[model samples]
Target chain A: MSNAAFVIIAIFTLAAALAAATLRKLMHAALSFAVALVGLAALFFLLGAEFVGLALVFIYIGAVAVLIVFTILLTRRDVGKDRGFNWAGVLIALAVFCGLTWSILKTQSLSIVAPHIRALTVKRIGEALMTGYVWPLQCVGLLLTAALIGALILVMEEKR
Target chain B: MTPTLQAFVLVSGALFSIGLLAALSRRHAIFILIGIELMLAAANLNFIAFWHFAPQPHQPTGVMFAIFSIAISAAEAAIGLAMVIAVYRHYHTTNVDQLDQLKG
Candidate 1:
C-alpha cells in the first residue's frame, strides 16, 4: 500500500512540475507549483520523514507559494498570451537533461553510509540537533532572524 | 535500481530539469523565482530518498537539512520577491531582457 501511494505521489509530482513549467498563464503555473510541492511533501511522508513532510507543506505550500501568488496579484493582473514555444530553449533544456542523466548514472556506484530508519524520528532529530549540532542550529536561527529583518526592510523601502 | 528509490530519484531529476527549463526560458523575474523554488524542492526530494535508503548514526540528517533548506528557501523567496518589486518600480516591467543597463 505504501509503495502504491509512493507511485501515485510521484506521478502527481511529475505532472504538476511539467504543468508548472509549461503553463502559459503565470498564475496557473504558480498554482501548479503548489500542487507539486504538496506532492513532494507526500513523498517525504512515504519516506518516513513525517516532520520534514509537514514542514514542507507548512512552509512551501502554506507560506511561500501563497506569498508568490499574492505578489503576482499585486504586481500584475493579466498573464499575457503564450509567446509560442522557443525551439532553441527547448533544445538547451534537453541538452541539460541528458548531461545530468549521464552524470547521475556515472555516480551510481558510489555509496554513502546512512543511518537506521528508526533513528530518524522527530524526537531523535531534535535531540541530535540540540546536543551535537547545537552551534550550527543556533547559527541558522540567527541567520533566519537577520533574513526576516532584511525582508522587512526591503518591503518597507519599496513603499517609500 | 530498487523500484521505489529509482522512482523517487527519477521524479526528482525530472522536476529539477523542468525547473531549470523554466528558469532559462522565462524572462519574467517572478517566474524565475518560481523556477528556483522548484529546484529546491528537487533537492529536498533527494535528501529524503537518501535518508530512507542509505546505511549511519544520524538518520535524521536528511530531514534536518530539508527543514533548513525550506527555511532558507522562504528567506530567498522573500528577498527575491522584494527585489522584483523594487525593480519593477524602477523599470516598470519585470522582463529580464529589458534590464541591460549594467551590461556595458
Candidate 2:
C-alpha cells in the first residue's frame, strides 16, 4: 500500500523538480519548485514524520516560495529570456545520478524494510528540542536573527 | 510491507542531481539559488528517511537534524535572494555571466 504511495509521490516530485530545473521561465520554474517541495513534504509524511512534513510545507512553501516569487517580481527586467543553457551541467548531473543510483542498488545492507514506525508527535519533538537540543536550538535562533538582519542590510538602500 | 531504505535514497539522489542540474545549467542567479534549495531539500529527505528506517529505540536525532536543516535553508534562501535583489539593483541585470567586475 505504502509502496504504491511512495512510488507515486516520488514520481511527482522528480517530475516537478525536473521542470523546475529546466524551465525557461523564472516564474514557472519557481512555482514548479514549490510544487516539488510539497511533494517532498508528502513523502516525509509517508515516512511518519508528520511534524517535519508540516514544517517543510510551512517553511518551504509558505516562506521560501513566496520569497522567491517576490524576488522574481522585484527583478523582472529579464524574465523568460535566459540564454546559455550549459549542456555540461546536464552531463555532470546525469553522471552523478547514475553513480548514486548504482551505489544505492549495490548496497546489500540497505535491503531491510522500515521498522515499525512510532508516531513521533510534536510534543515529543518539543520535549527533545527543549531538553536535549537546547543548545543547538539557541544557535539556530541566533543564526535566524543574524540572517534576518543581514538580509535587511543587504537590500537596504545606500547613502549618497 | 514498508518500502526499503534504498528506494527512498534513490529518490532523494535523483532529486539532488536535478538540483545540481538547475544550479549548473541556468544563467540566472535566482535559478542557481533555486537549485541550491532543491539540493538542500534532497539532503533533508535523506536525513528523515534514515531516521525513519533506523532500528527501534533510537533517538530522534535524524528528525531533529532535518528540522534544523530546514531552518538553515530558509535563512540561506532569504539571504541569497536578498543578495540577488541587491545585485540586481546595483547592476540592473541579474545574469551571472554578465557580472565581470571581479573577473580577471
The lDDT of model 1 is 0.78
- A78-131 per-residue lDDT for model 2 (tens digits): 875687898998999999999999999999988878776668888889999999
Fraction of real interface contacts that model 2 preserves: 0.88
- Superpose all Cα atoms of candidate 1 onto the true structure and report the RMSD in Å to 1 decimal: 2.9
Over A11-47, each residue of candidate 1 has an lDDT whose tens digit, in order, gives: 8988998898888888999999999988988888777
Candidate 1 chain A lowest-lDDT run of ten:
A108-117
Could you tell me which residue pairs clash in candidate 1? A113-B55, A114-B54, A114-B55, A114-B56, A115-B56
Model 1 alpha-carbon drift over 4 Å, by segment? A81-87, A103-116, A157-160
Task: Give the distance in Å from residue B18's predicted Cα in candidate 2 to where it truly belongs.
Answer: 0.2
Give lDDT: candidate 1, residue A135: 81
| CA deviation > 4 Å runs, candidate 2 | none
Query: Native-contact recovery for every candidate?
Result: 0.44, 0.88
**Model 1 CAPRI rating:** medium
